[model samples]
Target: MSTEVKLSQSTAIRLEQARTKGMSDADILKAIQANDVAAFDAVSEEDYRYDEFLSYAADHGENLEVAVQDGYRITFNTRGGLGIYLEKAFGVVAEKDFAVGEGIITGLKLKPEQAEVLAERLASNWVITESKDVPEGKVLTLKLRALV
Candidate 1:
């Protein structure tokens, strides 16, 4: 008995392009097997481009995380908390506002002295948590919690 893996149209096009560049079928299959899907034993309908997101973040030297509390209320948490903080503290305007109940912004370029001030200012109805020296001092992940 044998099984077949159905490649998406994009993946098929990529395979053909690789073939035109003189790559052997074995090598192309190996590359496809390595990247076209995750290692789980399940079929995927579309590519999520997780690799692309991570690669871009790495190239730009950014470590960001977002968390939304369960059953968060827009009326209580408000929608523009993080945006307000970003604009006031760092003189940076958020490209978009966070969804209600999704009130945590984790990546910011902050100096050690500035972290305390940021926490204090956002403390009104919001909780501020800091993580430092993750793997090294080069990266920081801030976890902000909002009361809803």
Candidate 2:
């Protein structure tokens, strides 16, 4: 018996690029068959955007705090520390967070750069706003409003 699998346009482009780089057709096919290939590898990393969270929020209406013209608003509070906050907010803790002091992080708004980092975990179009400043030894509250 024989089987045929269709390649996506992006994957086809990747296959061609690999061939141009001296990879054999048999090798490329073997890699694809083994599921060891990544389509994004052929593209620029800077161009990738994560928007799964937006889709989920849109479909389920879970965190509909306020509806903006293009998206909705959601909020997150952090009391323990950046590590704890990241784990709770995005479900992943980065090594850099561990290196930082475990002291409580309060009123820390998500910067544009930080948003990019968070997007890698929970892809969403959002803007972070600090509703109130964190007093000494207080928790941080952040308002994240979605954007189209």
Candidate 3:
């Protein structure tokens, strides 16, 4: 008897890349099981952006998850952080609370770049606002209203 397993697009691509680099199937399977594979090894640009979070997880040996509540609450594990250039740039604390308001200006406080990246990735209808008088000189707040 034989058993077959299906792999996600990203995983398949990674497996192929690893094979091309002379990694045996057994070695690849062991590495994957141990969570010790390099994220960007032999991956093309197209697959890399397919799901940015997967690359982050593979890189840090940690998982990143996001939760949305009522289309307003946007929270994610910032373990590996977002974006390739700014992994550890911001000092964000875990479980940070951001008030949910209906166009009343209340949400997560993030750097302008960080806010935009996260907002765009999470939803297309997020409203981002920047306030400079809030001690940080220039901070962008992320607010989600609806997914319409």
Q: lDDT tens string, model 1, 1-148?
A: 0222222222222333343445555653454345433421122224322334323333543221110111111112233544443444344445432122355554554555555544433434455454465332212333434332
Candidate RMSDs in Å, in order, are 19.2, 16.3, 14.4
How high is each candidate's TM-score? 0.32, 0.22, 0.28
Best candidate per lDDT, number? 3
Clashing pairs in 3: none
Model 3, position 67, has a per-residue lDDT of 12
Could you arrange the candidates by lDDT from highest to lowest?
3, 1, 2
| 2 versus 3: better TM-score goes to | 3
Global lDDT of each candidate: 0.36, 0.33, 0.38
Number of clashes in every candidate structure? Answer: 0, 2, 0
Better of 1 and 3 by TM-score: 1
lDDT tens per residue, model 3, 1-40: 0222222223333333444546555655454455554533
| Model 3 error, position 135 (Å) | 3.8
